[model samples]
Target: MARTRPTKRQLEGLLVTALYGATWWGILSSRTPFNWVLTVASGITAECVRHSSGRDRLDCLGDAFGAIGGISGDVETGIRPYTNGIAQTKTQIISHALKQLPMGESLQQRFLDRQGVNTDWFEGFEKRCAVLVGESKDGKTFLLKWRLQRFIEQHPDGHEYYIGDIDYGRCHEGDTPNTWFDSPVGQAVFTTADDIAAKVRAIAQDIRDGHDAAVPTLIILDELVDTMEDMDRDQFEQFMRDLKTIKNRGLKAGNITFVLGLHSTTVGETGIPQWLLRGVETIWLYRAGQERANFLHLNGKNIDECPKQLARLPRSFNGLRPCIVYSDKKLSVKAIPTLDFGNIEVKYSTVELSAIQQWEQDHWTPEKELTVLQKMREREASGKTPYSNRDIMPIIGIRQNQCVRSNEVYEHAKSLILALWESSKKSEG
Candidate 1:
């Protein structure tokens, strides 16, 4: 059919519609504004009804709307609410699209190791080093903070520390009030990669020299892969070198722990060296889609040894998020509980110096034993007695030095014992 030219009024209406469409699109999202264009055409149909309300008017609004859509404004496609009730029908279409996914997913639910869907799989990691893999805003930090909270509460004798490209120096207040992560270790602990590198080297060296970190301690590194990518050549080398030393010593020492967070598990993508991943036997998986293939390429083994659910984590706001926990070469699905910080920000983590000092004193070491006499003097003032050397020495499994010099020291000990015996006898008499 041949198309007729639009009248002056129709042309003006079309121009107005075009202008509104352009403005709506420019100010909003990337997708084209199709719904809004149809809405504008509906307004034009309303104008047609207004002008010809009583004379030669279309019988119904459905025909008018359809005519505005068609070339000659005459074709009617049924009900008054747009063509074939598309506006209402769209809702049903969307419901079908989203609803069927979860239903189908439930049917395909298979566990790699007797995995129950969305069940809480408490991860047990025997190794000291662990890797947490997740993308941005996947609650990686929130989960990390929760782990730290649990560690602090459970291990009163142990200490917790946080280091990262960003300072997560806030209490874990998003969920529980008075959470263990309430103490922020301060932003100074982790503000820059260079500073982090230096601090790591120093702490690791101190542990090796037996100067500090006598008790079990957890050291957390957040977004280290991102930091590595931003490093200079020399800086990266130094940082990795320091990290390697720290990882090896910390893992082997058994008293130290390492929790490293990265967006990717692969060296090519994450900028984490192969050696770093090599030392980590346990990898806590998050909602990363490229799970199986990347781990296979990185470690020559499957890190996604769990049920295939990570790729399609259920969209949620306040529910347990699915995570695949890989440990001891075993794969399993875990519904990791989420943490909420409640917008609390603490600047510095308070460390109880007295508690740490008390631990150091109670911690049995040969060097500490040499100061036993001084400590005994303090104890005696409070009507407290120190452990007898003889009893403690046996349990200590000391290999005695029986040289002449050593014998002289023992003779001096004997003289002191005899003197004490004489004093006791006098007092008894």
Candidate 2:
């Protein structure tokens, strides 16, 4: 004869004990490595047999057996290996999935298939804020840039990008304040945090109202606080407060992710309020000093084994090679090489030299062409390059001083213009 099943109360009681008590039920359900069908089936069977197994009533032997089977399957499939003290609750699992889903369709689909999270599930999700403490000029910018590119490439759907770098130069001129990111006009604008916060609020509004037309926004602030030497404590506090306000209010409106970058010491050194620190979820520490060591904690533990590679980083490598640093979770120090600007891809049409003749053909009338030639002649007589910063800055909003700071910037800009000019001449031919 087939065995009889237990009542719902008996089953619940057994399952609860098997899962190490009610507090752990959420983790058991969500983090179980066993296939969902198998997990549910096994759980049901354990419930039916728990009381009849003749095991200690408090032991819940049947449910324990089921949990063992589920955990075995989970391990084979490479699920969470160790629970440690951290709560692997269902809520946390779902929260982590959503945060990382912006990376690609595969991830999004994985989360969608779970069928556990409700439509309003993410409403209460709040991850811990992080403090990325790193040494000065230790490829922090490059790492931040890489993560950003990865996020953008993975999420083809519209995402907002806000970058704040304190090192504002003459090259960044004539940019508008708080523009939507999808258009050329918006892309043309170089922004500060103040500009980004306002834009984030607007995008968030569109998302909250179920305005299907709105796109997600990714705001990246490079060197988050500007002019460190000039900004005072109160002023810095206010700036951070404004950003916190924007973040708190914007979450309801749309998908807004902020990737803020700053030297590890800026906030502490400048006497900025620590209240801003509470708003960050994950702190990606690049290279930090001893004083700021306490701020960086990994997997809920203080990182005692800091990487020595960060000790002495050279700013400029052999004209070609990029400076690199390691910061992977497993290795504690994953190598991140510099990007090769020469090999970087450009999707939109760039101003190429070959296009010069096309420009002359399409836009420059014979009279205009002749007039330009005359002007070039006059410039040659004056010992000036007809193509100087004066001629280009107005069009690109890049200043001469900023471009000239490093030979790399100057050469790149110069090469583009030269390429365009040559291309135009060839087209004219």
Candidate 3:
């Protein structure tokens, strides 16, 4: 006869019984010298059983032990858990993440105040059009994501649209594009190259007619060159034309900003149109070859400062290369540290939570989970906070109060964050 399977209730009872037995043994054995060892062994055993069975009930038990072990570790180190995930109105994601990173100066203040520019310079817009180019693993996408998140946080009232092959396949997959277009945020997000071009043209016409709203609109195009590669020449040219028109009219009124991210090879091999390159007022150069460096006129004297800047670029401990930001008036090289969201639990709005659940349902699989776990371990080894699907799920409001590992870092980091905020105010004053 085949073995009988346990019911869900039976499994739950077994898990509770095992945990209670472990706790009792740990407590009773505390009088002995090997008490700590026994306690630790019990936790390890729980985890082993979780993996051994591959059953949901055992997995829950393992997670419970993991949470307990994690909390115990945090308490042992005196590191207070920073669970402030309630999204703040003013770039809270960046600000909260910054608290966990060690930076010479706050990035939020530097971008907003210093850099020899002011918000008024862009008129009502936060910034102008910029192209981010880098070699693979050089952190172009990371920087773009950071900038985009900051923009969304800063301009809550503004419409935000993103087209990319990142986590979401909204624009990359055929059906997702239609799904996105049907969503509440669809009005702002474009699903195709043609759609984006058309939207830009319409916005430009509205700006020309002086009928555009005062609120800013930010659009991020990731891997633009690659995206254009899939489009016909006419479509590409039309998109470029629309971009140029938008850059001239939309930028001055401070009503729109376009952020384009591309690979260095894409610019060299495919050759971005001169008009699009000229429209880029801000350039961020990551690790690229000499040929790639040649495109950047950093000094206006053909001094080849790009190569030198690229050489001096810092390598992040977490395996990301730094980049230099060059503008018309000022140039600065900075490495954006990877911020850990592990300790910071975040809550999302209803719509956002629903989207996250749907995304999880669509993408989550055993193979994917294993891959994510492996990556998380690598990140942890590099002294960075690793964000797993479990961590993100809670932040996006899919789940609640998930215990992401704490770094046990000092609480003083909060003061630095506050100081950065004060600096922004000081600059304004």
Index of the highest-TM-score prediction: 1
- In model 1, the worst 10-residue window by lDDT is 56-65
Q: Which stretches of candidate 2 lie over 4 Å from their true place?
A: 1-133, 168-213, 227-238, 246-252, 265-268, 282-286, 289-429
Better of 1 and 3 by lDDT: 1
Instruction: Score candidate 1 by TM-score against the native.
Output: 0.46
By summed lDDT, which 10 consecutive residues of candidate 2 come out lowest? 120-129
Ranking by TM-score: 1, 3, 2
Candidate 3 clashes between residue pairs 3 or more apart in a chain or in different chains: 85-345, 85-346
How does each model score on TM-score? 0.46, 0.34, 0.43
Tell me how far candidate 1 lies from the true structure as C-alpha RMSD in angstroms: 20.9
For 131-213, candidate 3 gives per-residue lDDT tens digits of 77765444455556556555656666544444443223433212223222222333444545554554555555456657544
TM-score of 2: 0.34
TM-score-superior candidate, 2 or 3: 3
Write model 1 residue lDDT over 1-429, tens digit each, in one string. 121234444444334333333344443443456755655565565455445543222122112222233322223223423453332232122123323443322222322122344544444442256777765444566566666655555566545465664434433323233232445333324656655655565556455555556456676777777666666786677567766766777645545776777777754666777666655644444435334644653442335444233432332313455666654555555665555544434334334545323333233232333344444445556786543445332332322442133554334343433444455448659
User: Which candidate ranks first by lDDT, i.e. highest?
Assistant: 1
